[model samples]
Target: MQAQTNKTENNTNRATQINARDQRVVQTVGEAFVDDPRIVCRDVNVFYGEKHAIRDVSIDIARNQVIAMIGPSGCGKSTFLRCLNRMNDTIDGCKVTGTILLDGMDIHDKQLDVVPLRAQVGMVFQKPNPFPKSIYDNVAYGPKIHGLAPTRSDLERIVETS
Candidate 1:
């Protein structure tokens, strides 16, 4: 249809306009908000010292909904994803400012412990990091430390089920 073609052209125009972007986004297009959201992020911003890596981005991730974050390289996809569980906190001089809530709990709260939070929500990196020599150790490590399994037998079962 002509309308679909026009939309693609418009999107291409927008992409071409954003050459080496520096200014913060005033707003996002499309339906960025949703009803019955499980994760709510409002005005989320990330700064690596002086560089504003992620500008004022906002969105609502609805419960049981599949969402995809598609963008070119260095557009802050990974940086913004790290903001979800406060992974940016580990990086020295990397700061995040805004409201991000996971099921109404403020992840940015200083009093919140990151260990369990990480277990609850974490990133599966593109490549496995420092995996133990054995594939079994790599699979069982998380369950072992998290006390998911009470005994070696249970750990084996868990790994097998996985």
Candidate 2:
């Protein structure tokens, strides 16, 4: 009985230490905001049914700057990213709150159409499956569909630049 109690105390102490360390890391990392932000997220929260997936998260993404979301699996990184473009709307019970702004415009506004929003903010999935098209066609798909390039040569230029 004494050995069992000692083991339990050791496990509790280890868990407390780990939780403290994690809190420090979360506090220190990715808390700075930029002067000119391309995207801003304020007081964001996400819920799927009864599960609170994300809570009170805020961040800024600046133009021409790359940010990485680093966390363990099932830690709401993907959920938070999907919220940027209102992708969570597809799920039946998923709910998002707070403000997500793209160039100072609220992305979750009723007037905003998700189709154009998705075209503007692209997401690359983890799975690798080639589109059934020539490399040039695949590359030009977005610009062509969005009317960004009116002519073939324009599309070629866009693809080349990209």
Candidate 3:
């Protein structure tokens, strides 16, 4: 009985040690990046076959901050913007590597779907074209399509908010 008790105690101690180690690893990783992040791009690169579009780039965007990328044409500002939503997926021979994280989750992971990811992150085009339809129709379209509003009155409220 004493030998069995010792064996059980040894197993319990091992589990406790493992749990402690895991907690330390989690804490260390969290602390390493959490001090500053609204966006973090690490060693990001984009290539179109032999053509390199974006070189290794690392940047951080803090909360409530605006980040702008400006450069001559073909310098990868749009390439990098498309990278945010994996829009590069459509281009032939386009390849992207390294890591881009939003709120600390890998955006490029195969498990992450781009559609909803885009809806949440949101995007407004650089152009200033207004909707051709009436303001009411223009504003109502999104909520109606997405079923965000169940009734006409609800859609009216959404259009007003827009």
Candidate 4:
């Protein structure tokens, strides 16, 4: 009985800690917009099947300014970031709603192709998974696949400059 009581107390303490942490996170992100933002996200929500992941999130990312999303585990920081570039589209039963604008253009517009949009807004994953290719091939793949470089010499120049 004593052991059970101790466990219950510990769980209560953890819950309290999590609540306080969430409050702090909300306060920190209260002012989510910036002047002259390069990217704008409004009323964004994400749902995975029946699980609601992100809720009514709105923010602005300013040009040349870096912003970090800080929150407790499972607080939807990654989900929110993935929504910016529509990376969540690949997931099964993952639904995202809201407007994400890049340079005043809607990224999710029907006329806008995803391939070019992905290239324009680059995403760096937390895990490093280098492609199984030569260093030059890895560096040149994006430009070659996207047809950004029209010739072999152009590819070489791009790789060198990068």
Question: Model 4, stretches more than 4 Å misplaced?
Answer: 1-26, 128-162
| Pairs that clash in candidate 4 | none
- Candidate 2: TM-score? 0.62
Choose 2 or 4, whichever is better by TM-score.
2
Writing each residue's lDDT as its tens digit, candidate 1 over 1-162 gives 000101122222221112234522232344556667888887677888898776555677778766666566567767777888776775778999989898899988889987777766656655445332377877886787678999889998999998
Candidates in order have lDDT scores of 0.65, 0.65, 0.58, 0.65
Model 1 off-target regions past 4 Å?
1-30, 125-162
Report how far residue 73 has shifted in candidate 4, in Å.
3.0
Query: Candidate 3's error at 115, in angstroms?
Result: 1.1
Compared with the true structure, what per-residue lDDT tens digits does model 2 show for residues 32-147? 35678999876677888887667655567888876676556566667777888776776678999888899999998899987888867766656543444577777886787678
The model with the greatest TM-score is: 2
Q: Please write out the lDDT profile of model 3 over residues 41-103, one tens digit for every residue.
A: 666778888876665545555667555654455455677777777767756788998788878
Q: What is the lDDT of residue 92 in candidate 3?
A: 70
